[model samples]
Target: MGTESSVKAQAETQIAAVTSLSTPQEGQKNRSSGNFSVENLPAGTYALKFVVEGANSGTHFNVMKDVSGGTDPTIWSHVYSGNTTDVQTDRSFYIANPSGTNSNFTVKVYALH
Candidate 1:
């Protein structure tokens, strides 16, 4: 029984750690034009949120497709524009593993007025 309890406790601790680590720090920004990776990502669906700084008013914001590892990333389910500027916009994608292997990916956000 003690062994079982220990295993359960360890599992709970691991779950907590993963939940805390999976979430990117709020207000984090990536300004470079290269492949950015999310390490130890839980295998499931996730939304990639971007906060566009310096976006001009009246321009449409597009979450461009991913262009890394020769795989094309799809656009978000919704489009952002105009008054939705300078905020965290989210787009969903799926991951199948949590290994260190980087699912190398890139995305470009553009203005389309």
Candidate 2:
């Protein structure tokens, strides 16, 4: 196959491991709050994007990326913690991806503070 074809194949394989959040469970901490996860991600950086539809007044959501260590067979290290804001009016944000194998991602929602 050609180089372009090979690259496209690799990208497809990587994207296959990425999953989007279909449902967010209401958090016990707050009634307006909720959480969701993107599970079974491969070892690479992924762009975390989201869209919030039908949000009531004073409701907002944020997508955060957290990562653990990929080195050493021992303890895991928290490499990064970055967040993107989605105000009720804006309703969207793009957060950077997590880097590591089997790392988990979460989206948190709450009343505008």
Candidate 3:
């Protein structure tokens, strides 16, 4: 494969590792919030990205540790008004999943340091 193709292949794999569908399991209920663990990751710096299936038309989404008055910390909070594709990185922010429940969108982690 060409260099571009090879790089794309690797990226696809890494993306798979970090992507999580919000759809609930067999009999579970759809949650008002979702969580994605970017764990085992060095406690350094990261860029967390979210892609809401076919959303972005003035939709509401948040990525944090608590949605209901929990004292957990938050890193990415916004009311997006555009598609969160690569070109529009303002949709991207820095925040780990904080290891438990309390996420609201598809999150991808990129380590930068």
Candidate 4:
């Protein structure tokens, strides 16, 4: 919040971040099974960034957030490369390589709450 915020800026909020490593049975990687839950987040919008390792399945990845506590695969807000987007209205975020396979992966979120 800078020059146009309706409410006066309070204080410098601490940087919030989390990292998770995808685990799929016995040391292998697979899609749809490797996801990290974004829990204990405050009620506000957040910008997310990701770093994926061992990308053997695909280049294009979709980052989705589970607004609800349940890990419902059908309902997710997804973002990716070539698509300009930010600040998902949520209390939790989830990230994973939907097309990834055969390699261990990790996703980190430098969340601005």
Candidate 5:
């Protein structure tokens, strides 16, 4: 019984350590004013929540991932494209303005564990 108790305690301690290590960092970015870019992200999953404001029904904007930073736009991949609506998606490094003279939006980024 002593041996079993010791093993269980050790297991619990290891689990606690791992839990502490794997805790997600609280890094949130709110881009409520205008277009923005989120760079230097570590290798992990992420969540992007955005709201398209003051755009027409079909005003199309794209959320892209700039793997090569801002130097190259040819390599940008559109991770999300939405009109005037509030939607949540994953993975965004940069945001493009909607196609119109008067169209803009806001985005909120959160790290997912």
Candidate 6:
């Protein structure tokens, strides 16, 4: 195989470790999961995946990135919004929340490249 083809093949076979930003829980509307630090990880775009599991129907989710460090954290960016899953990319992220009643959900963060 050519050099370019070899690199592409390696990347395709590599599996990124999935980090759970928050455990599965019954989420409340407008309630934030709070700021999480990805400072230890390398600087690269990451895919934030949110999955709604259990008995929470009609539940929606949203994500924010690079929240301010303070008593009241400010959202730097709103990267995602959906009910089942969000594959939005961001280098830094802070919060993920559910916006419907009885929201049993979880958010998984994984590096993309």
In every candidate, how many clashes are there?
A: 0, 0, 1, 0, 0, 0
Task: Say which candidate scores most in TM-score.
Answer: 6
Model 5: pairs clashing at backbone N, Cα or C within 3 Å = none
TM-score of 5: 0.30
> Highest lDDT, which number?
4
Model 4, backbone clash pairs (residues 3+ apart or across chains), number: 0
Sort every candidate by lDDT, greatest first: 4, 6, 3, 5, 2, 1
Per-model TM-score on C-alpha atoms: 0.25, 0.24, 0.35, 0.38, 0.30, 0.39
Candidate 2's C-alpha lDDT? 0.28
TM-score of 3: 0.35
Clashes, model 2? 0
Model 4 lDDT, residue 18, Cα: 37
**Candidate 6, after superposition: displacement of residue 98 in Å?**
1.8
Q: lDDT per residue, candidate 1, 22-104, as tens digits?
A: 11224523111222333342333133233323333222223333444555443433333212222222232222111221222
lDDT of 2 by residue, 8-100 (tens): 322212111122232333341211122233434344423332323332222233333322342212111222222222322222222222233
Q: Cα miss at 65, model 1 (Å)?
A: 5.3
Instruction: Tell me the lDDT of candidate 4.
Output: 0.41
CA lDDT scores, all candidates in order: 0.27, 0.28, 0.35, 0.41, 0.31, 0.39
Better of 2 and 3 by lDDT: 3
Candidate 2 vs candidate 4: the lDDT winner is 4
lDDT of each residue in 5-94, candidate 5, tens digit only: 665221100000000111112351211122244434333433323333444444433443334344413222222223122223323334
| Residue lDDT tens for model 3, 12-87 | 2122122333333345232233344443433433333344433334444444443345454444555242323221
Reference-based lDDT, residue 93, model 6: 50
